[model samples]
Target: MAKKDKADKKGGKKDKAARKKDAEREVVNGVFAPLVTQTARSLRTLLSRDLADCGLYAGQDGVIQALAGEDGLTPGALAQKLGVKAPTMTRTIGRMEAQGFVERRADTLDHRLTKVFLTDGGRASLERIAAAAEACEREALHGLSGKEVKTLLRLLLTVEENLQSAIGKR
Candidate 1:
């Protein structure tokens, strides 16, 4: 009887593990996560290739664009706007400063606060960045019609909202 009970417990454990795996499979296969991940990877690859000529990476252009819209933004503010951590922003800003793309200036009102400003080089490179981005988008959406593009945008926004809600729960 003891041996039979031990076997039953082992079978129960196996059943539990199988149930967990089924749940995981449902999450992975049903969630569109793989599609989203692959699409993101493909877009990043295309963007990297296009931006190579300008000597800027995929994420750096965002900073340039942000600065173009609102110059003299603090590092913390830029980090938050870009959805990046402070250290990562600091490293990127440091690299941009070294490459003469941006400069750090001490705020007049608050000497402790440093603001980032785009240099002449950064402003000049904006055209190239814009061209590269346009080319990448055009290539990615080569076959999509205007209406299809709009539909795709709507669907993607919906997906983003769904994911945002899921993240909020966490």
Candidate 2:
């Protein structure tokens, strides 16, 4: 009976050790999500400060950049491209219009469709916006080597694609 009791004690210890190891492994594996979230928050804060100097907000930069790529996009198209809702895009466009950065006009051929175009002031801000984004990226990648930066970008893209696929599944 004593021998049986000793065997049970040894088995219990092994079980506890195995459980501890699994917990540690899970903690290590779980760090990816939090780290990515924290990094995104930090990057947004940095970019926001830089963007503020250009007389723009964090999200406003994306709108400007998208317009620069292809001018005269509809608010709905902008919303879809920016991954925002229509109302949010409308408010953003209204604020930009008020700021003299963008203007809305009816499409010539299809007057019913409203198109957003960059105003003269918005076109002038392009350089400053580019500089601000460059500065933000520079600060974010200060220590990393070129290769490391490329690898990080690749991994992030892969992760993003995986997440997008998962979202589509749901």
Candidate 3:
């Protein structure tokens, strides 16, 4: 009777949760996912903690933020800024419209385009979302000073740009 390899043993699909946990460990245990996952989940947790009562989900808050920044943007333009496709942005915007957070008007200049606007309720939500997001950032970057935070942000952005450049070449 030979012992089974840990990888093979773990590979057996016991249940969704078990499989998910295993996969997470593989991807996240060491450094890559730990940092990313912690950063992401913490943000979500903090945002939810501060914002769930206000009825904003992670993605929806983003849409609200975008609308608040620019009062009248086409769904296509919103999609580009949010890094999503037009179809996806359309769906998100539709939901927001239903929720009374946004209003869409047909573009007078371009009837084919629908412009998105934040309502009064939507503007208030933006304030909440911004506060929640900032709270999460403060929580996540607990030790860094102002200058350290600035330097870290610059370095992280540079890394993101370099990664994008490499990806583009490939």
The lDDT values for all models are 0.92, 0.93, 0.83
Clash statistics: count for each candidate: 0, 0, 0
Query: On residues 51-116, what C-alpha lDDT tens digit does candidate 3 reach at each position?
Result: 777876558887887777788999889999989998999898888899889999988998987799
TM-score of each candidate structure, all chains considered together: 0.80, 0.83, 0.72
Candidate 3: pairs in clash: none
Q: Tell me how many residue pairs clash in candidate 1.
A: 0
Weakest 10 consecutive residues, lDDT, candidate 1?
Answer: 27-36
lDDT of 2 at 73: 100
* RMSD to the hidden true structure, all candidates: 9.8, 5.1, 11.4
What ranking emerges by TM-score with the best candidate at the front?
Answer: 2, 1, 3
What digit string (tens of lDDT, one per residue) describes model 2 on residues 32-134?
8999999999989988998788789769888988999999999999999999999999999999999999999999999999999999899888898888878
TM-score of 2: 0.83
Worst 10 residues of 2 by lDDT: 49-58
After superposing candidate 2 on the true structure, give the runs of residues whose Cα lies further than 4 Å from its correct spot.
Answer: 1-24
Residue-by-residue lDDT tens digits, candidate 1, 125-162: 89998898899899889999999999999999998999
